[model samples]
Target: MYSGRVRPGGAPGVHELARLVVMKGVVGPLATNVYVLRDRFSGDELLIDAGAAPDRVLALAGDGPLRYLVTTHRHPDHWGALAAVAAAAPDAVTVAHEADAPAIPVPTALAVSGDGDRLTFGDVSVELIHLAGHTPGGLAVLYDDPTGPPHLWTGDSLFPGGVGKTHSAADFTSLLDDVEAKLFDRLPDETWVYPGHGDDTTLGAERPHLAAWRARGW
Candidate 1:
């Protein structure tokens, strides 16, 4: 179990939003990221991507209720622990995009679509941004804190060096276009991106590389 104020190697540390505390840890053989978002006021928590080691993931929730178990996408590595975690927290609602719901291993209570659909717990609200192409239902969560820059939880759609890998040239183009228009075009440079795996990066760090990524064809 990992518990600390910061992750090593300069990845994003524990971030305090307006009313939430965010912590991240690597889980599963694929090293998928599992993020715990705790509402400081209500002690309610949301677990993002229960990829592996259900016991370890559940332990991270502490004494608060696990209100939501969110699967960023339908990939096996991203929801490998969903069954176990959902069984443990029966009250927690399972969430995923409607298009990807059929592919998920567990039953999802909330099949969300469109952009700006909000899920609130206590005073914290997370908005869903639809970013298709990586998958038909690819999505990223946007945490808009009144006091800090927005935090984006991009599943595998957007990453540090480039967008997620696609099955074809058309898919790659689609992923890149959606990412540029929905994320980079709309959010500020200071927006922090926490991808499904690996280190975190900011929109500013990736903005200049758009053309390079386009030329490389993913």
Candidate 2:
């Protein structure tokens, strides 16, 4: 048995010409936050980490053009909803890094993702970044424009206070370095960071904690 919460007002369903509504699925004991990125101007939506309640994903999507199902990692809690999501959005393509590609139940429609891979949803653009740490094939997705900092979907590889665990390799120094270089170092300081677990945070807030997390061997 698992527990989860539904966000109030449901972020934004459909913004105007320049509005982007983000529906967050606060689910399970983990409080996993699944996001539905919708560009009201174009009537298109992109889903990120459908780990929360399946119903929440459907409800948030409503009648929008559900296009992409992006996963940050292969963890069940993160990509577990792949099957359910496929059922709801049949035409959606499940995108993940090659390393985590096998985790998706329906790999036939799987698209190979990697650092610098660009994607689109209506008028929104998504970029993939390989931020392996919590798992051998962990991933992170970045959305960008000429506006502000890029929005990062940093799986368990990174959170507000720390990075994901290194249970497999028994060491996380490399993962820490990856985060420092590939994520924090490259992204703008004010980037909006939406993690697979816990509440949302920013690159600026997470940067200072990097040294501490690395020191702890996370």
Per-prediction TM-score: 0.92, 0.86
Span of 10 residues, lowest total lDDT, candidate 2: 1-10
Instruction: Estimate, for each residue in 148-217, the C-alpha lDDT of model 2 and write its tens digit.
Output: 5577778888777887778644548767878899988888888877777666788898887776776666
How would you encode candidate 1's per-residue C-alpha lDDT over 1-218 as one tens digit per residue? Answer: 22222332234346666688887877777878888899998998888899987876777777768888888888999999999999998999999999999999798899997777888876788998888888988889998778888889999998889999899888898889999999999999999888998878889999999999999995
Model 2 earns a TM-score of 0.86
Q: How many residue pairs clash in each candidate?
A: 0, 2
Candidate 2 regions with alpha-carbon error over 4 angstroms: 1-19, 168-171
- On TM-score, the leading prediction is 1
